[model samples]
Target: MMLEVAIKHAFGGFSLDAGFTAPSGVTALFGRSGSGKTTIINAVAGLLTPDEGRIASRGTVMLDTHHRINLKPHRRRIGYIFQEGRLFPHLSVRQNLGYGAWFAPTPAGRQDASRVVEMLAIGDLLDRRPGALSGGEKQRVAIGRALLSAPELVLADEPLAALDEERKAEILPYFERLRDEISVPILYVSHSASEVARLATTVVALEAGRVVAKGTAAEILGDPAILPAGAREAGAVLTAHVKTHHPDGLTELEAGGIALFLPTVHAAPGSRLRIRIAAHDVMLSRERPEGLSALNILPGTVHSVRPGDGPGALVALDTPAGRVLARITRRSAQTLALSSGATAHAIIKTVSVAASDVGAAAAT
Candidate 1:
């Protein structure tokens, strides 16, 4: 296990009781504001001690109320990447990163500065100060500094919340690489479904300070019922591989022998990718629909149907690609008579599959 947390804590009118096990790779702590995402992170970081519980990582005990074992924050060997890059004003980028390496309690395992700089692609910014760097560049530097410390775990509390969409796009790939190539397990906390669907290998969703759902990203991202007000935009993550790109501005992707074409992706052929087909963007038909302008039509069987409070209903399909989700009106479902084990077709537009949702599998 990468991390094990079981705790009970409180603050005035509020109370927290949560526990989870983070496996290797990235484990996402998903919840809305005040759902105790940061509170759990603080407990693991030693910034906030739980009234009673045990926190351990990779066979090393961090906190145990029974044994009265509580390690100091520095002694815990954990790295933290905050929402904002907090760098020294006067120090150069290289100097700031070296500062983190200097305090390596275990210098034997300390990461080489040159390797860390190259991993984050910050070699050119070494001589510059923090004030002269862009928001994305500063965040990359912050990540490199944390890696230099050779921490056991990495805690990211909405690390991209401060960046605009453009900056977020610029740095997302580096994070993907960090999760794939690096050995450290990341406990990522986020409220956005897209981020969790993209980067997380496992998801432990929380509500009211308690875990409501936990599983692989495919299982959690496909079910909208557990998400807080995320049903309208809920979707499923499909593992795909690039087949080829054509001059007509379309790229073909394969998943379980099913071909999916979308807007041109710059990634080379044969690269693995993940695609999220939004439920609302998917349409269903009892029979294969023809004479339509839509480029993608997947044949599948209806697995289940869940009705929402309003006119919406979630239809799950077992397609060749994977378990895809479709959102339609209850009336349409009744008119089409969609039910468990019913044969159906899922239709999606080429333009609806956004580039952000389709990312390289190597980056995963």
Candidate 2:
């Protein structure tokens, strides 16, 4: 484990008692509003001292309430990126990046500024101030600044919450790049399922200040029962390679020998991508239907069925591409006799997959 956190704190009506271990890649603290996502990240960054418990990185303890040891925020050697860029207005982008480097204990330990600038593609904006940059550009610089600090861990608290859709699209790929190219582990907090699906390697799901589930991104997102956002946010991530592009503006992808067609993906042929298929967008069929307008279909066996308190039921299918989820009503389940070991076909419309749900696959 790269990061270990176990903390408990209370303020007013809400109480937080959460603990989890994060491995080398991006570990997302996922939940809805006021679910202790921010609180946990703050505790890890040494900004908020927990009433009890401890936090450590790479076996070095940053906080231990029992031992009366609580390092200050500056001494923790962690970089924090807020919802907004929070760059210094008086300084140019170059100076703002250098500010992070100043905190490094030794000059030799700092990241190469030119390499970081090129990786984030912020070299062009280095001469400008924060007031002149767009939301996405500012965030890129903020990430660059954090990288230059040479910290052991990075903490991002809903970094995209302040951006609109277009700006979010612009910033997400940079985070993907950060996750793949950077060696430092990240403790990212977010309530957005799409963002979590696109970026998280390990998921620590919180609900009302408790860790309800923790696992790989695929495991937590695919299992509807464990999803903090319920069935609406339930989905599975499929790793596919761009096989070809059609003249009709559809891109063909191959996943485990299964063919999937989607809207024209902005990627070159043979490029790997992660596609998030929402459970609500999928339909189950006992037999493969014909003359359907949907362009994507997969034949698989029913793995499990979880019926909610209402009329809806979530079904899991073992498909060639990967684990796929379908949200159907109890009536439909009974009508089709859906149960474990039953054969079914999963149908999906090509247009149902929004552009944001597809992202460049992180390096394994």
- Maximum-lDDT candidate: 2
> What lDDT does the true structure give each of the candidates?
0.87, 0.92
Off by over 4 Å in 2: none
- In the range 71-96, model 2's lDDT, one tens digit per residue, is 99998889899999999999999999
Return the lDDT, model 2, position 134.
Answer: 98
> What TM-score does each of the candidates earn?
0.96, 0.97
In the predicted model 1, the residue pairs found to clash are: 272-361
Compose the digit string of candidate 1's lDDT tens values, residues 201-251. Answer: 889988888888999878888775675436865888889889999999999
The residue pairs found clashing in candidate 2 are none
